[model samples]
Target: MELLPVRPTIKTPAQAFTGDVYMTPIHSGTGPSRMTVALVRFTPGARTNWHAHAVGQTLHVTEGVGLVGTRDGAVLRIHAGETVVCPPDEQHWHGAAADTFMSHLAMLEAKPDGGDPTTWLEPVADELYEKANQQ
Candidate 1:
């Protein structure tokens, strides 16, 4: 057994996120393992761009409240200690609720061939985001 070295937190790029978001690497598996995990923190009204994962993704909320929405206009409100699973290749976005900060463990697996697992699309429009918050 070995203890992994801690990685510095990074500010999520504006290309794929809105508002202030940060990510701390947790685990990135190698070789036989393909799992990846990160602790993602979002400030109030912050959220990710529309994206989809080749192998699906899971978010376990660790603090405050969050919102997860899909292209079908379905939005789910997640609270601390809750977990949400997004199906593979299903366009979606997730982030902090309008009035609170949020943190979650973002877990997903890399593509088997070692390619990027996520396909990031356009940012979630402000109107859609506001509608989500109102729901």
Candidate 2:
């Protein structure tokens, strides 16, 4: 067995998110493994841009309330201890609610070819975001 050292926290880039977001990578599988995991934190009103995963993604909320929205105008309010699963290639976005900080364990798999597993699209429009908060 190998013991992994703690990874440093880093601020998420503006190109992929709005407001303040941070992440600490947990595990990245090597060789025959494709699984990857990270702990992501979002400040109040912070959220990711529209994106999709090549192999789907799972998020387990660890603290505070958050929102997850899909392209079909469906918005879900998630709380600590809840888990949400997005199917492969389904466009979606997630983030903290308007008045609370949030954190979650983000788990997904890297493509077999070792390419980026996520396809990031435009940021969520303010109108839609506000509507999500209202939901």
Residue-by-residue lDDT tens digits, candidate 2, 26-133: 999998889999999999999999999999999999999999999999999999999999999999999999999999999999998899999999999989999999
lDDT of each: 0.98, 0.98
Worst 10 residues of 2 by lDDT: 126-135
Off by over 4 Å in 1: none
Q: Ten-residue segment with the worst summed lDDT in candidate 1?
A: 1-10
Model 1, position 94: C-alpha lDDT score: 99
Clashes of each: 0, 0
> Model 2 clash pairs?
none
Return the TM-score for each candidate structure: 0.99, 0.98
Across 1-135, the per-residue lDDT of candidate 1 in tens digits comes to 989898999999999999999999999999899999999999999999999999999999999999999999999999999999998999999999999999999999999999999999999999999999999
The predictions' CA RMSDs to the true structure, in order, are 0.5, 0.6
* Residue 104 lDDT in candidate 1: 100
